[model samples]
Target: MSLPLDSPALALRAAIHGALAADAPLAALLGGAKVFDVPPKEADFPFVALGEAVVADWSTATERGTEHALTLHAFSRSGGRAEAMAIAAAVQEALHDMPLALAAHRLANLRATTAEVVRDPDGRTFHALVRFRAVTEPL
Candidate 1:
């Protein structure tokens, strides 16, 4: 049989993007559904962008699976880190322990691992890095 061609990481990212884009609370906080895999050069501040992701085999004796570690970045031009932190919190609320429909795979579990906010070197921009861990099994 030919090998199946499916990427759990990519599927997970797409599901995450869709979920965040459709979250009314997150939309209200960001002023819109300003979630992007690659934000435009002129993209507005206080937006969420998909960041890096790492996936590893998690197969069992009879199950094929993968574990994923993903990062999401929140950027804001507010005077302080409050906006960035708030955006990060909203992302966590929108995703943590939530079910995501992945192509060719099933999301076993997803959890927010950590979040950190910092002032950018520009001195006017704030950034928050939120990380999540998830396990996926082939369908």
Candidate 2:
């Protein structure tokens, strides 16, 4: 078997990007607003893209061949803390459960470093940090 050229981290990123894209109200609410802009309705809550993910090296922690780390920045524009957390939780669920781009990509572990509300100049922003691990079989 041949190893896939793309890394598991890239696959995870693609999944996340796809999930956000499919969330229409989220796209519109956040797309038109800035980092901490509040949305009128709960459904239109924004999912702001802070920046590109910083992937860490693979590690050996369990049965999985390797572990990976991805540092991503994002926020939701919601008024209530519960609403923001719900959105963040949904994001976390997607990252953990989404299928890998390649068959070789397998998720082994996942964690969320930050998933809370933050005070910014613009307003209250829902901030979150998602960390996940994946095992990619070598070709």
Candidate 3:
């Protein structure tokens, strides 16, 4: 069995679980505070921002070599570009520690030259692209 690239939230959870199987430390990427009648806020406060990460999709097992791809996005209400990049770098470093087996033919290859922070007037989201390959030898 193999994982799919447009995987659901559950699948994303599984991918995160697998990536973080080593117990690495990371901060939250989203969800904190509400922009209700409380007050007006700037879009650059560190604490005002939230961090999130998920594996958008990856390849599955097939007769042909499996090509895995993952997209990680971080969001912030304040739209802090620097903060988002920092968080993205942390996530990328964590992913590097994935216990994927090179011998077992399980490896992740990065596609994007760099992780970028995407910001809209509404919010900010960091983007990173990674590709993986999974192979099994013949019995």
Candidate 4:
């Protein structure tokens, strides 16, 4: 009856990182698996960042669970929206309905909800935001 160290947020981020790193399509799009919670100094273009997650309790009569609101960001500086859009597609395809492992909980379900691609005000960078929902229960 010990408390779990892997919060819903941590589990979700780890799943995303693992999924993207393992997907060849997404790996190639980013020129490598470049998933991170924080991008490095002068990090390479076409990388991914795990953004904020708004979570809520989803307890049932028989089990404890959670519903997550997650955001994944794709960034590009190689110019144009094409690369960004393609990477976004790969991200969505990689995670949609795919299974993920949780360190301290069970992932009841995971699915992409919505996504959008846009050019930044700098006109040279492209940004794509992908959103997802997940249901988890304590293991």
Q: Residues 29-97, candidate 2, lDDT per residue (tens digit)?
A: 456433322223443445544344555555555433444455444555566455555555655665564
Error of 2 at 30 (Å): 7.6
What digit string (tens of lDDT, one per residue) describes model 4 on residues 74-128?
9998768888888888888998888788788888888889889888899889999
Candidate RMSDs in order: 2.7, 7.3, 9.2, 2.6
Please provide TM-scores, in order, for all candidate models, with all chains considered together. Answer: 0.95, 0.53, 0.45, 0.91
* Per-residue error (Å), model 3, residue 99: 1.8
Which residue pairs collide in model 1, if any? none
1 or 3, which is superior by lDDT? 1
Cα error of candidate 3 at position 75, Å: 0.7
Q: 24, model 3: CA deviation in Å?
A: 4.3
Candidate 3 lDDT score at position 10: 33
Error of 3 at 57 (Å): 14
Pick by lDDT: 3 or 4, better one: 4
Write down the lDDT that model 4 would get. 0.86
How many pairs collide in each candidate, listed in order?
A: 0, 2, 11, 0
Model 3 scores what on Cα lDDT? 0.40
lDDT of 3 by residue, 44-135 (tens): 33221112333333434653233334445444444456665665565566655454434324333323335666665454443322222222
Tell me the TM-score of model 4: 0.91
**Which candidate tops lDDT?**
1
lDDT of 1 by residue, 1-139 (tens): 5434587888899899999999999999899999999999999988999999888999999889999999999999978888999999999999999999999989999999999998989999899999999999988
Q: List where candidate 4 sits over 4 angstroms from the true fold.
A: 1-4
